[model samples]
Target: MQSDNPEDQKSTEGMVDYNRNSAAQQQIIDSQAMQIRGLVEKVSNIGTEFRIVDYGCGPGISTINVMRPAIEACRSAHPGEKIAACHADQPGNDWNTLFGLVSGPSGYLNGTENVRTEAAIGSFYKQMAAENSVSLGTCFAASHWFSRALHLYAPNTVWFADLEGEARAEMAAFARQDWLTFLRCRALELHPGGYLLVSTLGSVPDAQEKNGFAASGRGIYRALQVVAREMADEGLINGEILDNFVFSLWFMSEDEARDPLKQDPELSKAFEIDTLKVEPAPLHQADLFADSIGDPVEYARLYTGYVRAFADSTLRKQLFEPSTNSAEDADRLADEFFHRLDGLYRKFLDKYAFEIWHLTVVLRRR
Candidate 1:
């Protein structure tokens, strides 16, 4: 299900270390650890073996940060039970970096017994696990990505939030299809009564046009598009390519997320919603960074690194022809873009405020 499109270029270069930069992600994952552990414990009580899949586990940090703790909790609850944890993501992910952490002396899963760790490389939209074989599934901040491109060009915009007319409609369809496809796939992979916990970037309630996580006093995605246009104007990239480039990402509101289940009873019947909540944006990272760093330029650099980590290489592909541009040139242009962006971020540092929302959902198979 992997496509050789611009969107498939999700490499983890220039990415901020998740443990350090992603305070928001860490907070969400940490808040849910006890619940995840309880689910693992429930599965352990029913059988001698338990399996958990960290779907779309980028760089395997979630495996170490979230899943490893849950597995250990299960072990403590059921002394003799066996547990296996699998980290699933696209094949192009930084598995080397992930495994390096796994093999470290103080590895996340170090000193664990009867717990096997594995790497599963593939699309979560497809059947990554055996049918009815998985006891628990966890996909955080990943399912919003579509399995394919939106199939239409986004005019002067990179995210669906800014698109209008047919472009907006096409992206809405894409989001609906991708969300349902993900649910169906997980439905098949999970055993009866197994649990699936998903947390994703969401939109502010009733804030129709403000659907992106903004940084530096403006939408980070909007800033990216602005820089892209400037790159085209300076002849650093082709104008047509810049106009046609889109990020192929969508953030749904709380109500929009519930629409799929409302429309499809058969799909809805497969699982029960344990919790569906939209948390107003958290400013933990903002406060922490301001207190710790206390410098605009360095703070901006850290923010840029965090954003670039998730969006690296994908946007870089638009700047030059694959046939003509050397990898070195593309990388250089990518770095240049971030350099300019970091300066703009410094200028807007005092005006920073978080506007992003998160959809925390929990589902259990029937």
Candidate 2:
């Protein structure tokens, strides 16, 4: 069910059609969205017209639904400056589905601004936003790609490199630079009294031995690699399946959360973080699905859509690699996963809990 409050638009990243398998993730997204909106509402320009821009807007469903209240409130309070919603996301993002949101009767925006996300560079954004075009900027859950400075989906060069550290450094540089770049771009876009709000999946590590996905922080991906490799050895799947998928995560101990900006000195130097709060909320497992279940496999399928979706992707990749056919075979695989999931539930009921780092950091444009 969509949220009753329209302000939910500010935190709509996780609502993408990417097949969230884990029901647990929805709560996290909802919690983080609320935090982001709460922080955004506190921005000094409450009375000012908002040129709202959703940085890294995913499907736009969540954003459109969540930001509704803000739009209506602003419309009620001051209608002089129209509400302009600028949605900036990656190049191949599903725009038809994303922008199609505007056709809805209760769309959260009065205007739509869509910009292809640059892999690392931020100059185009600066130019697209123009000088001082935005009154408010919002990004949620998507900043981690830049925060960790990971590789792009497709970089023009396709060159090979053997140095892992150099690659990591490059990724980090890209992340930090792009983060600062958006902040700069938004800063220039916002009027003197404008504000910017950003919220991403965050974590402050603790010694409590909480669950971090399973197997490893990269449990699903690493497990997929293992499963894929095994299937490949058995001549059941393609060896190149690995390149088609990528997943990454980051963790900062609670101490690190004390000053969230410390992770990126360059970004900190460029953008001043006015408010950074790291709050650990209990995983409301029941809130994830329409109804809760004790079985872990059912839990994964219903409660952990985010993780379950990834696992399903890997399984589908294995079945479809090189050759594709057999609707019956696909059905069989689905049945097998659910059946095995039942067994796995009996295997690790106590350790199945997923602990995510809920991070909230707001940066003012420099």
Per-model CA lDDT versus the true structure: 0.70, 0.45
TM-score of each: 0.87, 0.61
| Alpha carbon lDDT at 277, candidate 1 | 71
Give the best candidate by TM-score. Answer: 1
Off by over 4 Å in 1: 1-21, 42-48, 207-218, 281-294, 319-324, 350-354
TM-score of 2: 0.61
Highest lDDT, which number? 1
Q: How high a TM-score does candidate 1 get?
A: 0.87
- Give each model's clash number: 1, 25
